[model samples]
Target: MSDERRSLHTENVELQRRLEGLTPLLAEKETKLIKLEQEIEILNNKLKQQIKEIENLKINLEEKLKENLKQKSEGERIEQRFKLNIETLNNELEEREFFEKVFLKIISILKSPELTETKIKSEQREASYRREEHERYQRVIDELNEQLQQTNERFERLERERNELEIKIDELRQKNDILEMELELAHDKMSQQQETSRTLEEKQRELHLQEKEHRSAQVRAQRELEALQSLSQSLANENKGLREERADLEERIGELTEMLNIRENRVKRAAELINEFLERYRLTSGRLKQQIGRQAEDCEEFDRLIQKLRQMPIPKPGLVQNLRICGRPGVPRLEK
Candidate 1:
């Protein structure tokens, strides 16, 4: 930015030199100076606008980056939560398997043939232990009944959790779809911004080219003015020859007029083409909603220029001889 400022300063210094060189030819130096000032002012305003746009784009990108980071963190947190839930479910399943094995073992011990064979040999011992055995069996049955109730409760809780997880999964799917749509919209916005940036860059390049061309034109105009001064001296001394030259000059003027008409037609055609492109661009933007206005943001300058041209009165006498600003499509330039 500083470099650009420096370059503009250099150009201003050069322009001052050129303006000094043209002072002798110019009858209204003060008026021309004021116009130059206005032109420079306009250019500065445009530069400021471009800077503002760049800043806005930077801010937008920063916001998008933050949003993406936030979403990523949220996704990671959800993933961790799911992992913990799965681990807890697996541990509960293992515990349930252990309980089933223990229950099977208890049933097998009660039905064993070894315990029954000892009944005949130790009838007195069996009678003495029978009450204890009955109490132990009752305790085992109570424990089995409690375990069964706990298992049933666990199963019911697991089913409830499974249903809840299903609901969460559905919610997550919907959120995923929403995020996808948001991503798509972000992509579209990025693309649109990129397109606008490219267009502005192209306009800047064209302006630079036009500036260079304008400088060359100034040099040519300076030379032409010098020639005109020399011719005036020669014409003052020779009447007949000067009259012939006057006729030739008139013919040249007519040709120039025709050339001007052709240029005007071309400019009108270019404007129409630009309008057509704007229409299509606007329609596309409208479908997406926002970004492109009904009357495009970039077209304001063009509209102003066109209206100014339309309202311009016919030049009279000496006004045609003076160099002045002529607003064209991409760049404004001096015309005699």
Candidate 2:
């Protein structure tokens, strides 16, 4: 039983380790999705500002064109640059959309509970098997206990029989003593009746026969006493052996009880841990879905900005170039 318990403990530890191992990967995926969402938001805001500036430039360009055609060259050059910027923003938007789709796929995969369910089911099956085995051992112990009780009862019966035999032997010995006294009295009477010599001889012969009968009875009583003593000793040894067997069975039952408790506790703890992890996964998945929606909104805002840019006119190169400078310090170069 102790061996069974140790095996169960080992199995529990292994299962817990397997479940814990999945957490880090889930966390990593969530972190990456959040970072991507943040980047998309920043890009969207920048594109919006650029589109607004293009609209303002277009408004100024029309007024400037009617006043002075000499500025046409500068206006054409600024319009070309603005188109290039719009193309770059469009490319960035396309990349962000692709990444957003990939992020959704990752979230969907993470939300799946198939693997966790399988693991939990497997653990439950193993626990059930152990419980069955424990019950089997318990039954065996019960049977051994009953056998021990029966053995004890038999020993008690044997002791009673031996006591009865001893009493009978004592009675037999007293009868032998009484018969010997009678034989002695008969011999003296034979000696006194000496007038008829032949009659006296016949009486002496009868007294000798009675002595022989008494001796035989003594011998039979002694043999019965010896047999009873031997039987009693054998019964005592058997009782001692039964007691030892009972003790061993009791110890085994104790070990099995301890084992069962340990297994029950382990299963409970594992269940709790799995629940916690599952709850955390649900929360993270919810946040990821929200972020995905936010990203989609940001994409739509960028789309609106692109349309505004297409409707706009040109701007002075110097003014637009200065405005296009990075608003945030240490921001990385905007990729096409």
Candidate 3:
């Protein structure tokens, strides 16, 4: 039971360590989740800003197109006025022929390849500027799309990681609950162990007391055995005197009957003493009871009879010579 308790304690300590270890990991996961959410928020703001910039770019492009259309209309008006001036020059040339060379010079200057090339270059520059503007806007849109895609990917990854972290958190919570239950079980086991220990202690005390009592009974049985053996020896010695009175034994039959009655009374008293001992104490020793029973069977009545015989008048010397008391002569604590 103690070993089991130690193992329980060790497991509890290990679980506590695991719990402590997981606490920091859980906190770190939560921090990462928070950071991911913040990053997502930042990306959303950036996207909004990019969308606003696109709106501004569209507005600017519309204004630029309107300005270009106005410039185109003004150019058309100038070209028409130049054509009317050319018609007036042609009429004057036909009428006078004097200004024809100056008019031709003006027309040649107006029709010069350098001027046409310069006009084409200016139109190409305008077209190139518009193309560059469109390309610039397209590049910005592409960049924003790329950034959005990247943000989406990051969001997906963060969401997956967050799901994993949540699962880990749930598992940790379950483990914590299981550990707490195990701790409760361990506490209950410890309580049961304490109870068992107390019960065992009580049993040990009871056994100790029983053993002490058994030892005491054994001592008493030994003393009784010794007393019975001594009494048997005394009776054996008295048997010789009794035999010596063989000639008078027939005449003393009545007296012998009285002595037999006394012996019977002694037997009854010894039985009563054995019953008293049994009734007064718990006797669990089989060997002690057996030894006592054997000794009682041997001389149950004689030892007690010897005790009372000392108080009686001595038999006549001729018939009962050498009759004597035993074992300190006069102690009367004969429990038979």
lDDT for model 1, please: 0.47
TM-score, prediction 1: 0.31
Q: Which stretches of candidate 3 lie over 4 Å from their true place?
A: 1-114, 129-133, 240-294, 301-336
Which clashing pairs does model 1 show?
none
lDDT of 1 by residue, 27-130 (tens): 34344445545555654555555555545545554555555455455545655655565566556556655654674466456655776555444545544465
**Candidate 2's residue-wise lDDT over 220-335, tens digit each?**
53344345335434543543454465553344334433433343344344334433433463234334333334433433433343344335344333444332322233221111
What's the lDDT for all of these models?
Answer: 0.47, 0.45, 0.50
Candidate 2 lDDT score at position 121: 61
Q: State the displacement of the C-alpha of residue 30, model 3, in Å, after optimal TM-score superposition.
A: 46
Candidate 3 per-residue lDDT, tens place, 41-107, comes to 6555555555555555555555555554554555456455545545554454355344445544665
What local lDDT score does residue 245 receive in model 2, on the 0 to 100 scale? 51
Q: Please give each candidate's TM-score.
A: 0.31, 0.25, 0.41
**Pairs that collide, model 3:** none
User: How many pairs collide in each candidate, listed in order?
Assistant: 0, 0, 0
